[model samples]
Target: MDIRPLRCRDFRILMTSGVVTMFGSFITIVAVPYQIMRLTDSYLAVGAIGVVELVPMVLGGLWGGALADAMDRRRVIVLCEIGMAVLAAGLLVNALLPDPAFWPLYICAGGIAALDGLQRPSLNALIPRLMKRDEMAAANAIQGMRWQIGSIAGPALGGLLVTQVGIAAAYAVDLATFVVSFVLLAWLRPAPAPPGAERPSIKGIVVGVRYAFSRQELMGTYVVDIAAMFFAMPMALFPFVADDLRSPSSLGLFYAATSVGALAISLTSGWVRHVHRHGTAVLIAAGVWGAAVVGFGLASDVATALVFLVVAGAADMVSGLFRQTMWNQTIPDELRGRLAGIELLSFSIGPTLGQMRAGGMAAAIGLRGSIVSGGLLCVGACGALARVLPRFTAYDERTSPHGRAETTEPVQPADPGQL
Candidate 1:
């Protein structure tokens, strides 16, 4: 809503690049699953996609964060874009094979996931360098909007492309997006490592982990999100919920409901810039997300269920905006990437495990029961967390030491070893 951040040339370039790449990335996301289903026709094989990408994604995120801090962040982003483009080309070629190799699909998917992990930390960590600290919420909101566009339109268009044209066409589009992203990223100013920054290593990563845990506020962000996602994220149960509602055809609507809500929030996020008690804001928003999920679970009809999902989605966007602002406002620039990497894992691991949890619980209980219970657990977890970490709940941007220190000295304690 606040368009002030868009005035910066580099930020504009970066955001435009993100919009293009995310759109393409989502296209490939839909295409890959459809291709895999066509080739194997096994639910187990389709499920294995997550398993295949897991380890590589985790390692890539941690190491990528280290890499972002060690070298030029811009260079890291550019190189990863190139790598992803090559992977997309591979997907395109494989899709055109006389008998497309199933293994290559998995291979390419895993490879692309790794490149995504590698690229994101640098991408996120570079934001503060491009915008004034006070503009972080607007910047984060714009980025969220960019992602929502991809999530909503990319799949719709990709489905049409795959169904009407071919899988190869979808991959070709994804590859083109990477090319465009690379060009835009090339225009970004250099974001070099701090003078005393150490090369990326196992030790450096451990130091980053240690620093994150040492700060209660940072640790609170990670754990609270993990709890919220692990319990309340119920995407894995959408199909079952759709069936229960007797509107299996409306499955896509169920998926889109949350995105629609989140997009609405992103489009009208001007008010977020005024709220400085980020920790409290996150807690409230996450709790609302959980409550909405519970409402969704209790809804017996498709329309009611969708309304709850929309509310849940809007709440999630609010939490994400505040969480990101907290990170950017307080984190020292030198260690931003590594912290972002840990931040990545905290958010990523939750949804992955949440899907697994949803399925397991759905099997153990009825569909509605799983959704209801998870939502209750998510809400309860937030309350418990607030009680346990009072400092996090009380965090105020105006008076917090981290925020003050970041404003006064943008560069400090460059060496992880010294921490």
Candidate 2:
């Protein structure tokens, strides 16, 4: 196969299961918001539900890393998948109730968030263990492709199912996909804990955090992502923006537009494998993302705004690919799970906080003002990070200490003519 990572037996199985689970997760992403809206008829209610899950998710992910380092990664993922499925079933039962209440959703959301926190690190850590180091860039690109497609199609499909078949049916679809993912998970052989790995404990978690903090280049990745998401994530303000654009019906389009751009970038990602300066690439892509978000805020028309959003998504995908490559190429297998936990925090918590920030900004100045100011701040923050962490900007995979050492060719008898 041209895709080198997929040639490995383990990565393929994990990718299949992960992709399926991703689609299922996206369905819930839509279903939860729609359910909240139906239950309370308030945007505040919809937003609050996300808040409920944020803390548990953050904690679960970090702690899960400790467990992953101490246990079999495959087992951790499978168990988390089971936990998530059970939680989804709970939501389904609640929806079926004659008088569906809002409270149970909070509990379910928290539970699922915790499971997600635990599962993601193990899965991410599994990729490097499953594939060759040099093949990591392509593998990351493929993962980006799957994620972009799932983000785009999942919400669109979820909206369709909820509107036509009802919320219960949507939940049923999510639950079914979980079963499929579980079966796929079962097909993979055990990915056991690394040799000399410490037992899961608070001290273990602390060590992971300290190691992550010790790496300046890695810190750059995490902090830059957080700044970009926190300042420029505009999802919370999309509905208001859509109304202003006089296309209230195009809310779904707004939500899916970024993924469209991301998908486009992913399909033609062969060039990334040849790039040696991964950290520089990450900084550049993150800059582009910030600029695009700024453009999105300033655009008056729906067409222009959608165009900006697409650019932002494409930029974000590029940034993500480089970051994942760095992680896969550099990290020791023993530290992989713990580091993945920190990575999860950057991507997940940033957006959660971003949504909250977007809401506040929208209320403070105006919808457009929020978008423009946030985007501008994102650009500034990223620029500052780049300046403050020059080490990351100068990091070239060709010279990176963390990169795998090159294998020397065995000497053979000189050509007869040369001899």
Best by TM-score: 1
Which whole-number lDDT from 0 to 100 does residue 109 have in model 1?
87
Stretches of candidate 2 off by over 4 Å are 404-419
Please give each candidate's TM-score.
0.96, 0.93
Alpha-carbon shift of residue 410 in model 2 (angstroms): 25
Prediction 1 TM-score vs. true? 0.96
Give lDDT: candidate 1, residue 265.
96
Q: Write the per-residue lDDT of candidate 1 for residues 1-419, one digit (tens) a residue.
A: 89999998878989899999999999998999899999999998888998988878888999999998898787788888889999899999999989998899889889988988898999998888877888999999999999898899998889999999999999999999998888777777667776678999999999899989888888888988999999989999999888888899989888888999999999999999899888999999999999999999999899899999999999999999999999998888778889989988887899999998988998899788899999999999999999998889999889988861232224322221211
In model 2, what is the error at residue 247, expressed in angstroms? Answer: 1.2
Worst 10 residues of 1 by lDDT: 410-419
Which has the greatest lDDT? Answer: 1
How far residue 152's Cα lies from its native spot in candidate 1, in Å, is 0.4
> Which ten-residue region of model 2 has the weakest summed lDDT?
410-419
Candidate 2 lDDT by residue in tens digits, 62-172:
998888788877788888888999999999999999999888888988999999999889988878766677788888888888888789878888989899989998889
TM-score of 2: 0.93
